[model samples]
Target: MINDLPIRKIIHVDMDAFYASVAQMDNPDLKGKPIAVGGGGTRGVVSAASYEARKFGVKSAMSGRLAIKLCPELIFVKTDFERYTEISKRIRNIFFDYTELVEPLSLDEAYLDVTENKLGFPSASLIAEEIRQRIFREVGLTASAGISINKFIAKVACDYNKPNGQHTVNPEDVLQFLADLDIRKFYGVGKVTAEKMYLKGIFTGKDLKAKSLDYLEDHFGKSGSYYYHVVRGIHNSEVRPNRIRKSLAAERTFNENLSSEIFMLEKLEHIAEEVSKRLHKNNVSGKTITLKIKYSDFTLQTRSKTLAYFVRDKAIILETAKDLLYQNTLNNSVRLLGISMSNLNTKPQKTEPLKENTVSVQLQFKF
Candidate 1:
C-alpha cells in the first residue's frame, strides 16, 4: 500500500528564532546578544527568545521573571506585530514564486507543496536550499526547511536541523526515519499523551506500530486512529492553502493573582472585548465561547458553552463569558485569564459536539 501511494514533495519552512532574529536583523546592535521579545515584568511571558538567551534556558511562553533568573543579561523588547506581519508577507511572496500551494501556519512558518513547481526545479532539496538562501538574501533572516513526502514528516524533519538549516527524508527512508523517532517528538503527542503512551509501553514509532489499531483506538479515542496511521508513514492530510481561522482569542497574566470574583469579572470583560474586536476584524462570528483560567500554581482549567446563534458583539461575548465563569467555583487564585470564540461561520458544519474538558488541539505543524 505504501508503494502504491504517489510520493509528494512537501517542504516545511520555519524561521530560526523568528521574532528574536528579526529584532537582531533590523538592529545590528542586538546581534549576538541574549534578547527576548515580550514584556519584562514578572507576570509577562516571553514570546520569543534569541538563540543566545536559549543557551541559558530561556524559552517562549516562560515567565519573564524566570527567564531573567536564567539569563540575567536577557534583553526584553516589546512585540511589533505590524513589522512581523509585513515580513511574513514578503516571505510568502518568495514561496509563491515556487508553488501556489503554500499553507502558512503562522507569521514565521509554512508548508509548501512543490511536487510541481513553477521554477521547474526537479530536486526538492535544491528548491528548499534556494528558498532558504533567498529568504536570507532578501528578508535578511535565516530559515530552515524540511523536505519529505508528507506534511507530518516534513514538519518533523524541519526541527531536526533548525536555525538556518535544512533536512530531507526521501520516500524510501520515511519508514526507517519514523521507526527511530521518539514518541514525544511525534506530532499531536503532548506531554500528557506522551506520558500515557510511555506507561502503555509505547516509547517510539516502532513501539507504536506494534499496537493494534483496535487497541490504539480503545486507548486514545479518535486521536488513536491518527497515531496508528502516522506511525506507519501514512499521513494523507494535504497542504490546505488559505485555511479559515477557526478561532480568535485574547489572554493575559496578571502581575498579581486575582482572588476576587469582581476582579475576575472585570478582567473577563476586557478579554471579551478584545476577542470581539478580533472577530469583527476577521468578519466572523462564533457560536461557542470558552473561558480559560490558569491558577497561581499553574494548573489550568477551561469552561465552554455553545450558544444557539453566532455572536460577535462585545456585550454578548462578555455576558456569555461571565456565565461560564460564575458557574465554576474559583478554587484557586487565578494568575491568568483568557477567552476564545470558536464554531465560527454562519453556515455551521454538522459535527460531533466537543467533549467536555477537551480543548481543540491544532495539529503540531508549526514549531
Candidate 2:
C-alpha cells in the first residue's frame, strides 16, 4: 500500500525556541542564560522558554508563577512580536527562494514542498540543510528541518533532531520508522488519547497497526480512521501552499479587567476595528461573527451569529459583536475581548505577498 503512494519531498522547518532565541540573538548578554518571553507576574504565562530554562521543566503556556517556581533564576522578557514578525518574514523569504510551495504553520514554523524547487535541488536533505544553514547565517537563529514524503512524517521527523538539526525519512524506511515510534508521539494523539491507547494495549505505531479499522473506529470514533491509515504510512494529504484563510480574528488582553458592559462594548469596538482592518487587508469577508470573552478568572465564553450575507464593514462586525455581547449576561468581569469572522467568502490573491499581521485561526488537518 505504501509503495503505491506518490513520493514527494516535504520539509517541515521549525525555529528553535523562536521568541527566546530571537531575544538572545539580539542581546548578546542573554546568550546561554535561562530566559522566557513573557511577563513574570502572577497572572502572566510564559510564551516561550529558552532551552536553558527547559532543563528546569519550564515550558510555553505554563504560568509565569509556576515557571518561576520551577526555575527561580529564570529571566522573563516581554514579548516583542514586531521583532519576531520581521524575522519571520526574512526566514520566509529564504524559503521562497527555494520553493513557492510553502505552507506557513505559524510565525516560526512552515511546511515546504521542495519536490520541484526553484533551485532545482534533487535532494530534499540538501535543501533542508541549506535552508537551516541559510536561516542561521541570514537570520541569526537555528531551525530544525524534517524531510519526508508527506507533511505528517515530515512534521514529526522535524522534532527528532531539535534546536539546530535536520532529519530525513526515506520512502522505504517510513513503515519501520513509524512502527518504532511511541503512540504518544503520533500527530493529534494527545495525553488523553495516548492513555486510551495504552488501556487498549496499543503503545506504538506497530501496536496500533495490529487493530482493525473497524475496531479503531469503534474505539476512537471518527478519528480512528485517521489513525488507522496514518499508522500504516498511508497519509496522502497534500502540502497546500495556497491554503485559504478560514477565519480572521483579533484579540486583546486588557491590563485591567472591566466589569461594566459599556467598557466591554468599547473594547469590542476596538477589537472589531482591528479585525475589520485585517479582513479588508486580506480582501476577504465572512458571514459568521464570533465574540470571545475571557473573564477576569480566565473562564472563556464565545457567542456567534451568522448573517445571510458576508460583510467586511467594521460597523457590521461591531454591531454583531455588540449584539452577542448584550445577549450574554455579564457573569463576571472580562479580562480579554476578541472578535473573529468565519465562513469566509473570498479567496486569497496569489499575487499578493503574505502579510505578517494576519492571524489564521483554522487548524490544518494533515490527513
Candidate 3:
C-alpha cells in the first residue's frame, strides 16, 4: 500500500440531472413526468433528459426523433442557460460557505477540497452530508457527493449513490476500491479507449493495474500514463477555484506562402492535430471551431462555426476546420494558418498527479 496517504479531504458534488431537474422545479407541471430539455425537432439533439425520461432510454445527445420513439409522451422543453447559470451560482455560493478551494467542472458538478474547512470539521463525509442537506433546503434541488482522499477517487465514488445520495471511501480502502472497479467506470477511459482496453484483455482496474507503464504507453501513447496512474488511485491534482481556459489554439506559419487548397488542407490537418492533443491533455471539449487565415500582405480573416455539442476528437476537429477552410476562397496566399477552439465544456476534470511529503489526517471520521 502507498505510505502516509495524503491528508487532503476531497469531495465531488454533482447535481442530479441538473437541467431536467431545474426544468421540473421551475415548471411544476413537468414534475414526475418524462421530459427532455432541448432536441425538440427532427434534427435536434437532447441536451438533458429527466430521470423519468432516462428510464425509457432517452439521454442527453440522443436524437429528438429517437427520444420520442422511445417515449412517445416525452415532453420537450427549451434550454434556459440563464436560469441554469442562476441556479449554478446559488449552488456555488453554498460551496464557498465551507471552502474556497472549489473547482467547477461544469454547471452541474464541482470538486471541493475541504481539508481545512470553515466549519472546523475533520470528517469530509459529514461535511458532504451537511452540504447536500443544505442544497436541498436552500436551493430546492438534490445533490450527490463522494468524499475521499483525492479528487479522482472522490469523483468515482460520488457516482456510486447517485440522485440525492453519497458515498465515502476512507484512505485505507482506496486501493482495493480501485482494484474492484470496472475499467469502463474509470474516469476518462471513454468509449474508444475502453474498446481498445477490452481488446487488450484489460477489462477492470485489476487488469489495467497489471499492465506495465511501457505497455500502456505503447498502446495509448499520450494517454497511457493517465491509465497507468489512475488505476492505482494516484491522482493528486488540487482544486483551483479559478482554473479555466477561455480558448485553446494551435497555429503554424509557413516557410513559404502557398495558394493551393491541397496545401492549406495539409497545414490545417497538422494544426488540428495539435489542437486535439491540447484538448485531450486539458480534458476539455469545445463546440466552437475558428479558422484564422493570415494573408501574405498581413491582412487577417477568420471564419467560425459553433456546433450544438462539444467535440474533442481530432477527426471531428479536423473536419470542422476543413469546412471553415472551404467556406471562403483564399483572398491571397496564406502566410499563417491557425485553428482555435472556444466555448469549451468547462474545467479540466482529470490531470496527472504531483508529489508531496507525508501528511496526516485525523483518524476519526463521522460517517
| C-alpha RMSD for every candidate | 6.3, 6.9, 10.9
lDDT (0 to 1) per candidate: 0.89, 0.88, 0.89
lDDT of 2 by residue, 293-326 (tens): 9998889999999999989999999999999999
For residue 69, what is the lDDT in candidate 1? 96
Clashing pairs in 1: none
Stretch of 10 with least lDDT, candidate 2? 356-365
Worst 10 residues of 3 by lDDT: 357-366
In model 3, what lDDT does residue 80 have? 99
Using TM-score as the yardstick, the better of models 1 and 2 is: 2
Per-candidate TM equals 0.89, 0.90, 0.73
Clashes of each: 0, 0, 0
Which of 1 and 3 is the better model by TM-score? 1
Candidate 1 structure quality by residue, lDDT tens digits, 245-347:
8889999889899998899888888899999999999999999999999999999999999999989999999998889889869989999999999999945
Deviating ranges (above 4 Å) for candidate 1: 2-5, 346-367
Q: What TM-score does structure 1 among the candidates reach?
A: 0.89
Could you give the candidate ranking by lDDT, starting with the highest? Answer: 3, 1, 2
lDDT of 2: 0.88
